[model samples]
Target: MSKEWFPLIDEDKCIGCLACYNKCEHGVYDVENGRPVVVYREGCIDGCHGCGNLCPEGAIIYSGEYKEHIKCSCGCSD
Candidate 1:
């Protein structure tokens, strides 16, 4: 579990596919109203973005000091 690492889901981009929920091995997500929610944020691993990588809509993003470890597809990187 990590204090800084967690998933942020973009509701607009999310299609309620539950891909992130299904990809996560940890109890980090919960299905609510046919969508996924970050229920156990602290359960996220320090350098893991497995769920985000599996999202077809690219709805998931990670917030933490480990941002540099991931390649930003949206060109947000500087």
Candidate 2:
């Protein structure tokens, strides 16, 4: 399966608490320079919000929800 979800850490907002790094059971995060980094993007599980929800500073952002459709600008109908 493709890497559909991963964590995005905001350096400025991160308090270096390591809450996210510890919360992630998939080894998706690591500590470097007192900040959490996405070391293993492929290990992230799709649609899981465990790390983001555990982050105290709200520094972790999870992306990769699949969208079913896109609006066409050319006025085409599927």
Candidate 3:
């Protein structure tokens, strides 16, 4: 199974720059009404935050890394 991960866009922070849409090579985002939207959540690769890291407005939020806790087998946090 693929790891649970997706990008969340902050509408207020997004400037419609299309930076995130242009940076994503996995077809994870789409431009709708001049705004970015996650059209293919499953297309996003696990542990990949390229879109979020490339957002010029810092509007993209990646939840992949945090979700790793659910599958972690190492008892490092205890």
Give all candidate RMSDs, comma-separated.
Answer: 6.3, 10.6, 7.4
1-78, model 1: which lDDT tens digit per residue?
347878899999999999888877778999999999999987776667688777999999888765444443322232
lDDT of each model, Cα atoms only? 0.79, 0.73, 0.74
How much does candidate 3 score in TM-score?
A: 0.74
Model 1, CA-based lDDT: 0.79
**CA shift of 37, model 2, Å:** 0.7
1 against 2, candidate with superior lDDT:
1
Top lDDT model = 1
Off by over 4 Å in 2: 66-78
- For candidate 1, the TM-score is 0.79
Better of 1 and 3 by lDDT: 1
Of candidates 2 and 1, the better by TM-score: 1
Superposed by TM-score, candidate 3 places the C-alpha of residue 54 at a distance from the truth, in angstroms, of 1.1
What ranking emerges by TM-score with the best candidate at the front?
Answer: 1, 2, 3
Error of 2 at 4 (Å): 2.7
Q: Which window of ten consecutive residues has the lowest lDDT sum in model 3?
A: 69-78
